[model samples]
Target: MRAMVYRGPYKIRVEEKDIPRIEHPNDAIVRVTLAAICGSDLHLYHGLMPDTRVGMSFGHEFIGVVDQVGASVQNVQPGDRVMVPFNIFCGSCWYCARGLYSNCHNVNPNATAVGGIYGYSHTCGGYDGGQAEYVRVPFADVGPALIPDWMSEEDAVLLTDAAPTGYFGAQLGDIAQGDTVVVFGAGPVGLVAAQSSWLMGAGRVIVIDHLEYRLEKARTFANAETYNFTEYDDIVVALKRQTDFLGADVAIDAVGAEADGNLLQHVTSAKLKLQGGSPVALNWAIDSVRKGATISVIGAYGPIFSAVKFGDAMNKGLTLRMNQCPVKRQWPRLFEHVHNGYLKPSELVTHRVPLEHIAEGYHVFSAKLDGCIKPLVVPTAA
Candidate 1:
């Protein structure tokens, strides 16, 4: 099997590796058909996440055919085509019973925070991801769902992470009828968040980013007003002005770790590794929303200290909600939305690269070249 292995910061290559075998009674071995390089993967690629060991594969959004299943894996069979959520969890765990699958206590040894995530990093759980021909799926009965007959492979893959996280961001905002929502970042997650806001009854949606292509996608795909923060003297003030000086009813920070508005913050967090992640987007979210409004943060950040505006949030009575999304929890409604043609997740996919060319794929995506919004990885076996 060929798997994308992380060598060091800014270094990755597809190398031959052993296909993972079932390790537990509930485990399954999946032959990956479609996998995506998520924007969050860039954090790991750039050495932002802690405990990301060399030789580890990095991917969490993937769909595949069940190549083999342990005796206890009754929900799926060897031939089943399935979409696996990013989170690996035991369904009967306390958190899982409450629909908080992302925080399942029984999976990761370091379950003080996030649960097991496929191919994320050791901090989340040192589980190998599906950025290869085959991946080992633990607690297979609880995580892998058969792909719906009507769903496209591209859509199924996105639903594994990006789509659900975006929807979860919107849900965290608790947008009321006729509320104005502003989303920071126009990446796939931000675009999906902006689009999902409309479905949640937001009266208006606005997306912010530095890139013209992504902002353009926000305008067309989410039907939201777009802003290039690079063009503004103070983006928060600009957002306030756009919201008639009161500020937006809700604000979401979808850009994490490598946010690039403040040079000092970016340097300290992203370059020097002093802080967990750059707090520019989060601070902007706090300042751009109304005093009593909500702010949702779905951006991936390191599990360390970050310079945030906690004082201001408390003073303004803002409801700040954030978590690693429970991906499977959002699937029922998301499936309905996709089935009804309300969303075309595949439309966001800009490039598809073979596993052999994945290093180039990473480079293009990291450099933001060729208008790469979302890139998919197709294994040779697929």
Candidate 2:
């Protein structure tokens, strides 16, 4: 089998490797049909993720056909199409039972709070990712989502990460009916956040980004108003103007560190681009809201610690919630939304390239070329 192996920082290549097989009663092996690269993967690609092993497979967003299954996996049988969760977890854990699957203690043995993940790093759990011919899935009965036969694989792949993460962000935002929601970054995650806000009944959805292409995609495809941050010297003023000079009801930071701004100056700066709902965004959101608004952050963040101004947050009487997105918790609902035709997250797919040309796919996706939003890696020949 040929898999895209991570050689080192900023290095990945397609190389021959042994195909994975079911190794436990809870295991299953799926022949990856379609997989998509995530912006989080770029952290690993750029060497931001620590303890990244050389030659580890690198992908997490995927949907596939169950080529093989263990005896205990009775819910799904061979030939069942499924979308694997990015986070690795055992269903019987305390957290899993509580629906906090991402922080499952048994699955992510490598970390103190959360255990493991596919294609992330040693820090997250060193399971190999799905950017290859076949991937071994653990806790298959509990973790893998059965894709409805009616849905296309390409369309279903987004649920594996971006769509669910976006939905998770919105759900965390706890937007009220007719509430205003503002999402930073206009990337796939940002687009999903905006879309989810609308689905959650937000009256006004504002997407912020400097890229005209991304902003255009948000406005045209996602049906959200977009702000070209480059055009405005003061984005806070624009946001306030839209919100009657108050901040948004819910402000979600989807870009993490990728967006431009200072992390500490969140309270004072009108334009704050910290992680999802950074102190800056939080402050602005507090200002945007009517004294008791909720803010949710689903953007990826590193371990680098920063002091949050709780005093300011307390004064505003704001609610702050952030999660890595227990993606498994949202998968079933996302699948239902997709099946019902209420959600068309496939709109995020801007490029599709064969597995043989994955390097080209990375080049284009990383460069954000040709207006790329989310590039799907078609593993098998169509």
Candidate 3:
């Protein structure tokens, strides 16, 4: 088998590796058929995530065909097509029983906050991800679901992470019928959040980004107002003016640790590693929303302190709701949305790279070249 081996920051290559076998009774071996390189994977590529060891594969959003299953695995069989959620968990744990699979207590030694995630670093459980020819899926019954017969492979792969997380962000906003929603990022997740906000009955949606290309994508894809933050002196103030000086009814921070805006914050956090992540986007969300409104955070962040405006949030009585999305929990409804043609997740797929050249794929995405929004990985096994 071949996999994307992480050597260090900005260093990855396709290397031959041992094919993972079923190690637990509930485990299954999946021959990856379709997979995606998520934006969160860039944090690992840039050496931001703690304890991401070399030689580990980095990918979490994937759909595959089952190759083998452990004795206790019953939900899927050999040759069955399945989409594996990013969250790895046991079905019967306290969190899983409560539909909080992302917080399952039985999966990770570092299970204090996030549960086991495929291909994230040791901080989230050192499970290898699916950016390869094959991947080992633990607790197969709980996290792996059969791809609906009519769903496209691209949609199924997106549902594994980007779509669900974006939908979850909107779900957390608790948007009222006539509310205004603003998303601070125009990446796939942010675009999806903006698109999903309309489904929740938002009266207006606005997406913010520094890139003209992404803002353009948001305008066309989400059919929402777009703001290029670089053109404005103070984006938050500009946002307030658009909202009649009160502020948006809800704000979503889809840009996490790697957010750019404040020079010092990006320098200290992303460059120097002095802070967990840059809080520029999260802070913007706090300042750009109405005093008593809600803020939803679906951005990927390190498990450390950030320079967020906690004081302002408390003072304004804002409702701060965020988590590593319980990906599977959003599937049932998401499946219907895709089936009904409300969204075409495949429209977000702007590039496709083979496993042999994934290093180039990472470079193109990280550099934001070629108007790249989302890049899918085509493993040899596919």
Candidate 4:
């Protein structure tokens, strides 16, 4: 079997490996048909995510056909085509019972805060990923949802991650009927957030990003309006002009802290400095949100914490709710949306490179070149 193996920091290679077999009663061995690279995978490539073992495979977003299943795995059969959730989880647990599949207790025994995620770092779970000819799916009965016959593998791939994450952001932000929603960032997740706001009945959705191509994609494919953050000196002013002097009802920060920051001088005055949150988009979101509004943060955050100007939020009585998407909870409904054509999550998939060309795919996507969005790595199954 051939697999995309992580060699080291910013290094990946297509190499031969053994076909995976079912290791647990709840496990399934699937012949991967289509798999897409995600922004999270970039973290591993950049060596930002620790504990990634050498020779580990590197894909999570996928839809594949089940080749074999353990006796206890009953939700799907050997011939079923399924969309595997990014998180490896057991369906029954304290967190799972509460619909928090990202924090499943029964999967990652070493996880003190949150459970393991597929193809993520060893800090999450060292489970092998889907960027290969075959993949071992743990908790397969609970984690892999049967892909409907109507959904194509290309289109259904992202239901494993992006679409549901975007919808979760909108839901957590409390987007409601007739509410104006602002989504910061026009990456796959940001674009999805904009679409989600529309689906959830927002009166208007404004997507913000520096990339013209992505913003255009947001409008043409995701069906939402957009703003280029680099063009606007003050995003708050631009958003206010569109909102008739009031702010949006819901504001979502989909880009996270790395995209927005400022340098600070130390009080000691020894030429020391620190970099932390400036809340560039969050500040605009706070200013662009209506009084007593909410902010949903779906962006990935690093280990460090940063500061945000809470005075405005305090005065406005804004509520803040943030989360990584619980894909298990969102999968069933998102599947329906994908099956019904209400959501075309695959529009964000702009690149489909062969497994041998993964290095090129990484370079192109990492540099955001040639209107590249989410690139799908199409590996040949063994």
Off by over 4 Å in 4: 257-280, 310-312
lDDT of 4: 0.79
Give the per-residue lDDT digits (tens) of candidate 1, residues 1-382.
9999999999999999999988899999999999999999999999989999999998999999999999898899999999999999898988999999999998898546889999999998899998999999999888989999989999999999999999899999999999999999999999999999999999999999999999999988989999999999999999889989999999998998889899999999988889999989999999888999999999988888999999999988999999999999999999999998776788899999998999999999999999999999999999
The CA lDDT of each predicted structure is 0.93, 0.78, 0.93, 0.79
Backbone clash count for every predicted candidate, in the order shown: 0, 5, 0, 0
Give TM per candidate: 0.99, 0.90, 0.99, 0.90
Compose the digit string of candidate 3's lDDT tens values, residues 101-196: 999999899647889999999998999999999999999887899998999999999999999999999999999898999999999999999999
Output the worst ten-in-a-row residue range by lDDT, candidate 4: 265-274
State the TM-score for model 3: 0.99
lDDT (tens digit, per residue) of candidate 4 on 1-382? 9888888877898999999977889889988888989876776776555477888888878778899989898788888888888888887898888888888888776555657777776777777788888899998878888777787776688888888888899999887799988999888888888888888999988888888998899889777888886787777888888888788889998876445322341111111112222345666677788889999988765333345668988999999898778887887788778777788887788889988888889889877898998999888752
**Over all chains combined, what TM-score does candidate 4 have?**
0.90
Over the stretch 1-382, how does candidate 2's per-residue lDDT look in tens digits?
8788887666778888888867789899988988999988876776666677898988988888888889888778888888888888887788878888788888766776555678888888888898888899988888888887787776688888888888898999998899888888788888888888888899999888777899998988678998886687677787888778667778887876343444354322212322222344444454555557777777665554434556766887888888777888887677788888777888778888888788788878766789888998877532
Quote the lDDT for 207 in model 3.
95
